[model samples]
Target chain A: MNMRCTKARRYLSQAMDEQLPPAVTRQLDEHLDACRECRDFREDLALGRRLLGATEPSLSGNFDWRLQLKLNQALQKAAGETAYPWLEEKPRGRGWAGNFTTAAAFGLAAVLALAMFIGPQGRVMPDDAGRYAGFETSRQVAGGVSDRLPLNRGALAPLSAPRGIQRSVSGSFGLGDFSPNAAFVLDSGWSGNHLKDLATIQELKLRNQRLNNQLYQYQQQISILRRQLDRPDSNGLDLGR
Target chain B: MNPSRDEHRHGSPSAARFDLVETRDEDLIVMVQDGNRKAFDELAARYKNRLFSFILRMVKEPVLAEELTQETLIRVYIHAGKYREIAKFSTWVFTIATNLVRNKMRQRSRRPQLLSLNPAPADDEIPLDPADPVADPSEEIQRRELALVINEATAAIPEKYRIPFLLREVEQLSYEEIQQVTGLKLGTVRSRINRARNRFRQLIKPLLKDETLLAELEMIEARVAEQKDNPS
Candidate 1:
């Protein structure tokens, strides 16, 4: 295609989204009117967009109910976690009982997990707990090491003004607004030791690089001297090294 | 797609700040930050389907999509206070959704997954819209086949292009919004979308060119139009 056709086609997608400025849009319309190829390109892209958008699989009708259940569970779990931080710790401690306890904690937490809400008295919603009294007893399905590791508590300390911090399911690294616990976060090793370890690692990395550079300089000097000594025209001065 | 409807039909008694339905998402989120849990419910109601649909297209599994949508919404709820007015609420929400989708996709990639030709859909799936053009039986059958082809084309688009492309074509987000969502430059977003569109166009070119299908589709639309006009 010629430059004009290329430029017009470049703007075709933006035009489809109605994203182009009015002036650019007018110019694009002019191009499309004059050019059959650009016109066809726009039509084809529009058809594609229409076809893809047609297959929208809608959310279930009872979506809100399901979400409410999940939210209640989250609130209850948050409360349970605050009461027992060790339960929230990583599963580095191995063995049958360790695994079972953690798993049971999760399963029980899942089943007995109160679907709680804040009532007018600022009390946990006891009614939901009764409604979903028989909660799912599914085992804590941890996705290997990453799932087991606790979130970096220190990274979460600054934003403690709201509620306590809760990690999103898959967003394990992300720290968000939640229950209030700034005091605990400040004293935790997650920030201090983690920072110290990182600094140590970085320093080591830099020192290693410096040593390698010094060694390279020594090796270069040795190589130059050896070359001079090997040459028949070399003066005995090369041997003084 | 303007296809999503808020699932919360009954409004809650709380959310005393303003009319949750009438308020902008940004304002609603501010109320959420201000300790109104109902405001978050309103936000979740507004976003659940849209997020589910967007994630489903990426992950290609309904259950996983539902889980991710819930997780993303929960993050939005729990983290409402942390969210600043620096970005659009939709942009921020999609960013969280995108993260979950990427994480799930990464985890799924580790193990080989077998694709079932006909997977059972979740129980609560909303019924198909009656106004859908492919409502007739003959059109329905043809459309199913077409849908399979289109789905494959969608899955085939590379990950980087896929999100931006879907956000554009499916979510109908503006280029600027998409740039914010994907953390891509404006020009980069446009070019990637262009590449994706070009690739999809190429893959589905034969289907579009199938004159018989086109003619049949045209006939179906004509018949539907006639029915609408006559109402008998």
Candidate 2:
């Protein structure tokens, strides 16, 4: 091959690395077979690679330890700080916390259950202080102290007053003690609603029950998997046969 | 690459052992996620050198390479909780490193002044031996000339092509992995690698006028051709 042609062939040979369709590879191979200069160019390419092999990268002496320390520190910092805890675990589904909140709401409603039963009877008595204190405490525990008390007046009656005396006693208080804000404080009219209070408690209890069941099932499945893995295989129950 | 898809018809125990040593990247990820610090250390140890060299070559600064390597590992650690086992760990790590390098490149680019590109070659340049120096200087001169030409050619390759080129040629990542790391299409990666190699070849062709090295290469080619002509 002429000098120009030899260089051109070398270019084509290099191009073959990128042009690997069967047709292109075939054409390049055929050209290489006929062209001595191109074949020689290919040899130089291979020799360059072989010589360059000696220069493979070696790890710096402290690379591993340095990187490992950096990684550990970063992870430690991340763990120490408050982040979305849900983000750390693989996103499976809403977790125990979700169900726990629901269950807690139900527990609050159950304690408040008596308030609805007694709130509306008009039997003017003074023994409702315990139920009021309990309901308020439970609400404060289950839900954070906020500007609003989430009062459903219709739902409050049955739980607020189980009997007429209790109803009258609670009526004197008239949801005033529950409200930090006065204008929004519920009235005596709200004390007379019994059926709505029962309905709300029942609704909350149902939801809480469902969540509790789901939480239980998840726990059970996890335990079953753990137990199965924990059991020894006994090496196929070896016997001197 | 698709070892799982292959039928286990030929390979024996030794081949299986080789495969084990190759390390399924997903296993490493699972280990790291499980809070296995030693496994994480192993993962870092496996790729740190190659990744450091890549960063060093691109940034041309040892201290910067060290920082980037540390940053890459930190990213991996922080993201361990978020790691999806769907991809190879090496691909994920390289993707992180690639982003860091690209960000550094962008930051460097934003500077108005054209900062000097490569590190001073003198630090690595070897002095000729005084005890038995070459008498007829042409051959010794040719080697130095070739080395200098090769360095210039490699350094001159544009950033777009240089990464794929270096990863494929120097780091020996497969074209698929190069594409994953670079976030480029497979065809583009191959094209860039080819372009880089061809550029290097073109650069080296002038210095290769040395008759002796040229003859040796030709002899190697003839031997290869002869072996092909007569298959065992």
Per-residue lDDT of B85-159 in model 1, one digit per residue for the tens?
898899999999998899888887896666675566655543233444435777666755666677788888899
lDDT of 1: 0.66
Reference-based lDDT, each prediction: 0.66, 0.56
TM-score for each of the candidates: 0.56, 0.50
Write the residue-wise lDDT of candidate 1 on A1-241 in tens digits: 3239888888887777777899888888788778997888887888787677655566655667777788889976765565444458675758898888889899876544232111111321223323211111111223311222222343223233223322222212212243154421211111224575466446545544554555556765764564444333444343555
Residues B1-232, candidate 2: write the lDDT tens digits.
Answer: 2332111222333334433235566665554554445546667767777787677657755567777977987777667878786667777787888789989989978973445865554632322234223223653354444434445556677788878877766677778888888989976776677666667667666656667755644544454466469756
lDDT by residue for model 2 (A22-92), tens: 66556667777777877777776665554333233334455555666676677555643333233365545
- The alpha-carbon lDDT assigned to residue A100 of candidate 1 equals 85
State chain A's TM-score for model 1: 0.34
Angstrom error of the Cα, residue A141, model 2: value is 14
User: Candidate 2, which segments miss by more than 4 Å at Cα?
Assistant: A1-23, A83-241, B1-22, B112-152, B204-232
